[model samples]
Target: MQFQHPELLYALFLLLIPIFIHLFQLRRFKQVDFTNVAFLKKVTIQTRKSSQLKKWITLLLRLLALACIIIAFAQPFTATKTALNTEKETVLYLDNSYSMQAKGSNGPLLNRSLQDLYNVQLPSEKISWFTNDVTRKNTSLEDFKSELLSVSPSQGQLALSEVLLKANQLFSNAEASDKRLILISDFQQNEAFPEIPDEVTVNAVQLQPVNTNNITIDTAYIASKNGNNMQLKVAVSGSGDVPASVPVSLYKGKTLLAKTAVDLSSEKKNTTVFDIETSGNLKGKLELTDPNLAYDNSLFFSINAPKKIKVLSINEVNSGFLQRLFGQEEFAYTQQTQSNLNYNEIPNQDFIVINGLKDIPASLAVALQSFSKQGGSVLVIPSEKANLSDYNNLLATLGMGRFTEKVSAEKQITQIVFDHPLYENVFEKRVVNFQYPTVNSYYQTNTNATDVLRYEDGNPFIFQKNNTYFLSAPINLENSNFQNSPLIVPTFYNMAQQSLAVPHLYYTIGQQNKFDIAVQLMEDEILKIKDSSSTFIPLQQTKANKVTVTTIEEPATAGTFEIVKDADFIASISYNYNRSESNLQYMDIENWEGANSSASISALFDTIMEANNINSFWKWFVIFALLFLLLELLVLKFFK
Candidate 1:
């Protein structure tokens, strides 16, 4: 037993007041001598004795009542016998990952775990709650209750170590009384569980049944058959002691393509692979037939075949090296004479690499400028035999003008910007080494380009401007020794494929956000706004680069909303990205003692009760005191 407010014991001193009052004598009772002398003596003795007895009875009753009240105010309590006990401020760490949504003994294991938490009854306990995703390091039972009510299943993986570390910090100042941690989860073997703290007593409540079985899709890849083929890898897993066969099926556009059965070892996972030919447009689903764990049993995938890119080049004498660069599948290249330039007939490919356009006609120059403005990439290489004015005009259209500095004969190519995307993964480190031989003075350009492959010269050898980046230094095998190095092929291949291909590919296939729509900003604020109102209402942050708004029940649809706001807009409240409410994975309590781990709900509840125990003791003390006083009075009445 523990007394929360032991200082209240001093209130027993009030009993002294009654004792003093009882001790003080009233005027010596002078018995009237009206009665006979013998009767007078008896009357005197009886009166004195009876009066003394009454005073003693009253003092005893008052003191008993006072003592009971003081003891009650002291707030005494005893600890209940539990498998694990804690007197520290505890935080319950619950897992809310997608995998927790898997079914167990009582339907969804997560739901059953939550029900258990809600049913926990410890009036004298304090509790703080946290999930694998959103955690509150410093929180009270009251605050935890609010968050618990709002907890929803998150789609991300659970980080058990983090929750454990957090739990350790919560009770650092606590004195011992069996500080406890209880984990209530499915206890999946794949989930991480670290060692628990020696000082903290830990227990586990496995939510999963003894023999639950399941099969899941492990991975899916698109492999090229004609262009690209797709491969689907699946694994069957279970908790059963006996081996079982699981059926796996593949579907393409509502049509069943293949079905196969895979045998899984007892308490083990087995993998099976399936291949499909590239149809250029394929949307399909993979299904695994398992009695349990249905969420990961089915997988969806989509594949888009590659399309050919066409380009027109005007290289010097059609160099064999440059011809081979565009010789890959899905690339069609055409070379024309320098005099007969046809811009209208140029195909809409990724880019048009113009080797030397010195004597190009003004009409041709106008056509090239218009092509680039319309989202086309053009690589202009200046040669000693070409016109300069036309090239400068092209540069002017791209927010840059021609160079004013003359190339010095002593100038040499210097540092190269290896960080650029064009050079990324193009060559292995120290695999190939080559140096540029004697180079005739290359023309200088004022174009704001990214100097990717630079020369020893102070000026930029190769640079990029606008949306298009250029590799300016002459790749002519005669001028530079790059051809001798093994990196030449891969370097040119990656640059040609990645540089111009990025813009076109991203614009066509990437997720695009449009700003042209006329979005009505019904009002400037969103906190008190109604759903029926027409407006592009601002929302709070959901993820790294996303925002959302959600409507609740009682007159609205309960769903999430993806919101996009202008950069200038600002607000207070934020949004939540966690969309799934089905997941409720329970963290392992056994190893849940660290700066990151969370204390169990039971532990937190115990702490709160301990604090409230003080007040409860005081209230009980007053009641007991009153009862004792009444008992004393009854005793006196019956004896008298």
Candidate 2:
């Protein structure tokens, strides 16, 4: 037992006032003669003894009542521990990721958690709470109740370690107080459960969904494109027991373009294909009806009008191969000799190839360096029977390694860097034991760059610097047969494709996505990605002919947006939420050792209430005081 106001206990000494009054002689009684001497004396003695006994009983009752009253005012209570003396700080970690859209007993899991947080009673008035993208410190339940009522699912998901770290940072380090972190989440099975700290008491409330079945549109890609038709393939996947087939629809701005059903009866993963018009801009949306998570049900995408890449070749040899590869439909191929080359046309081209030049003019080297700085890509093919001194000087000027001397030994181009971004979608599988291309006579260079293709002896057959690609030997028919090999198509085609880096079918949100738009922006002008009524200006860099746009977390909602420069619409691009949370799998936090886990948030509040174990005795003390006073009144009225 402990007293709330223990100093009031000193008032107990005032009980001595009643004792002094009872023991001291304050009044004198008159002596009287009895009519019968012996009988009178005996009766008087019995009366005096009865009077003394009644006085002693009344005095004891009065003292008991006064002590009870004093103790009641002192506010005594019994507790199991001294927890009341320490201040408590609570930090709530509420998980509102897209995975919480799973259904629980009431409704969606996230909605149920929000309702519980709004209704559950807490011991402290001010608590710190954080969600995936929202945080508030020392806030009242009433103050955040409206915010909780309007909570929505987010695209961000923090791992357990990140949540713990954020929670610990919210606590104050200057004060010595009891810190507790209440983690309310669905506990998705995406990350590991990190160890809890000793100073903080962690109580986890894991919400369980009614079922784990979910179907998601994993991704979409351009399978193939013909004359006027494009084939789009979408990959669908499911968790738990799925249905036989799901209906997938293609819409262009709310107008249905095509409809198809994916067969999921035989396998958990399957693809469905649709063919649409190949030309023009397509603001496309692929949708499927799902009862589980809705974020991944509809995927937005765009297919902008095709922009031909500008390819230029400064050649001294026959240019038939370059013309054949860079067709008139896809590339604007321009061939110019050394004397006829126009330096002003260099800024407008996307890629430049210097092929078999006998001499590198000082003015040409300076022009290529300036073009490379303005985001133009270059590929240098050295010339046989060439001016080695001028070529080495050009290489040195461009920061490419100098060519030492020519080697006559034949070398096979055997290695390919399939992982490089230049070959990103080129190879379906790594090929081995194929007829490797060979170079008869090649120049050996001391270049320090990432080798894209290596010789049999680990020498660089083809290497790439920042924006320049180098072939160690010339690929003319007289010197090498690499131009006739099967690798020539994808190698030359992908290099041009990656040079411009046009947008994909769609990009996932909350990721670093970079692409180029060929539209040139005026000075002091910017590009905006517009979604509905909101517009976001992304991080951009302007080059000579195009603007490079990079987006991470803009236009936060997933949809197809328009890239607008001032008022004119340049093109359409798409963003979608990450499908990582599409699979409705949960972590088993209930069986975690040394954790205070609960499913009901209200129950956790009750547990906190019980943990204190403070049974107040002040009211009981008042009742005891009343009972003692009643006894004193009875003794005074009936003892005589």
Candidate 3:
């Protein structure tokens, strides 16, 4: 029992005034009323005695009425230990991973799970939903239905830890009557489970889908060891009690390269080895030939074409450093002694490194400028032996602007642009040790220069403009002490590959896009992705800061997409996927841990009522007040 408002008990103090008045009160009557004198004295004394008794009773009734009024104001309520009227809003967290496509009694595991949701007699009380892949909080039944309808089984695997983190965050601010979390998953026993938060009560729902007679090809790789040209082995395993033969196919783009079938048994795993000759655009898909196992039918994979990059280094013939660095087979390098070489006759090459070209010839400058503008890259390492004025003017023409007189290199520099693409992941930590071997004199650019490395005096040492890059030091191995440094290999490779050549696009199968293709950062302002008509669509990244575009078209198909940035193309992306959307089965509740757990939904309501004890306590006091009013009436009528 609790009082909703204990303060109302103060009304009992009013009863003291009534009692005092009744005890010490006096009344005056006319003398004629007792005219019977001596003869009527005895009879009058009896009546007076009755009148006094009635007065006392009336006063008592009035006091009781006052007490009742106070009690009523203090509103009393009962607190039941168990649920008297149990009603709960159970939040269902369903895991809709690709593995959920396993078959079950209710059809595919995922579909069965959804049907089970509809089966639960969730009261008129609203329901909230969540998914392992998506966040759903404070969601109504309709919203849940909508999300479920739109949910396609995802390809990316989610860690249990990440799922729990999202679930906790979603329910953090919920004000539901009684919150319950019901997780439905296959519960792949090998995976680690995350710790549940104390505030939330977790109920794990176990999936018992039909066991698959599956033989999946885990992976296939190619290798040639010690002049032995042999195809590598590919592993295959059964996902269930039964196993059968699975067919594998190798392809170059859409062309079939090879095909074979391997038998798999339930008792043991099997591996299939094959050898093939291929050139460009190779991909593979493995499929189970068994008819019963349709959900895990085919798995797709891609392998990149072998790369052959060539470089043309033009400089004086006596440059021993250039000769040594270019000796490696990793690059196909061609050396030209003439600085006036024509680029038109130059063969197809990935990069062009120009050395000792003090004043670039007018024709060569035009060719290099056009090449860079057309998405090719060039690294220009200047020399102290040539004309600085002509090169400085050339720098202005390339949009890098005029250069000031060169400054001597120091042992260490300040504010190295570690965040730049060339250096972002090149080093585990900051490179604190760097010695400048050649203090080559040169003019510094005043405008349009992206200073990659800066000295303590704030002078730019390494900078880039347009597609052309300018290194303050000679890249030739013998000319500088850079090759002796441990950071030389990775640094040079990363700069040439990443900083110079723009990346193709980034695409993740089965994951939603991070950035919308239409959106751009223009003129220092955030802009939305819009069509030519200026209609906007929301753009967001899936996980990385890189943009992901969610095309309304069939995203399961393979295709390439280009991203335009700052009038420069940074990366090219390709979408290659075949997302499966077959199964819809649910988990079994009987086998789940804490399945028989009992909890009263009304306990929370009791807690709220207890906090409002003052109000409830007054209600009981009020009922007493009403009873007192009735007693006062009886005393006045019947006693009179």
Instruction: Please report the candidate that would top TM-score against the real structure.
Output: 2
Tens digit per residue, CA lDDT, model 2, 303-366: 9988889999999998788898987576888989988999999999999999988898889988
Q: Give each model a TM-score.
A: 0.57, 0.84, 0.50
Per-residue alpha-carbon lDDT of candidate 3 for residues 241-320, written as tens digits (9 for 90 to 100): 54456676755445676677777654446777767554433345544454443534554543333333456677753555
Instruction: List model 1 lDDT by residue over 333-368, tens digit each.
Output: 777766775655653444677775556566666766
Native-to-model Cα distance after best TM-score fit, residue 219 in candidate 1, in Å: 4.4
Each model's lDDT comes to 0.54, 0.87, 0.55
Global fold similarity of model 1 (TM-score) = 0.57
**Weakest ten-residue segment in model 1 by summed lDDT:** 502-511
Candidate ordering by lDDT (highest first): 2, 3, 1
Error of 1 at 351 (Å): 1.5
- TM-score (C-alpha, index-matched) for candidate 2: 0.84
Name the candidate that leads on lDDT.
2
Residue-level lDDT for 398 in candidate 1: 62
Residue 238 alpha-carbon offset, candidate 3, angstroms: 6.6
Evaluate residue 21 in candidate 3 and report its C-alpha lDDT on the 0 to 100 scale: 82
CA RMSD of each candidate after superposition: 11.2, 4.3, 11.2
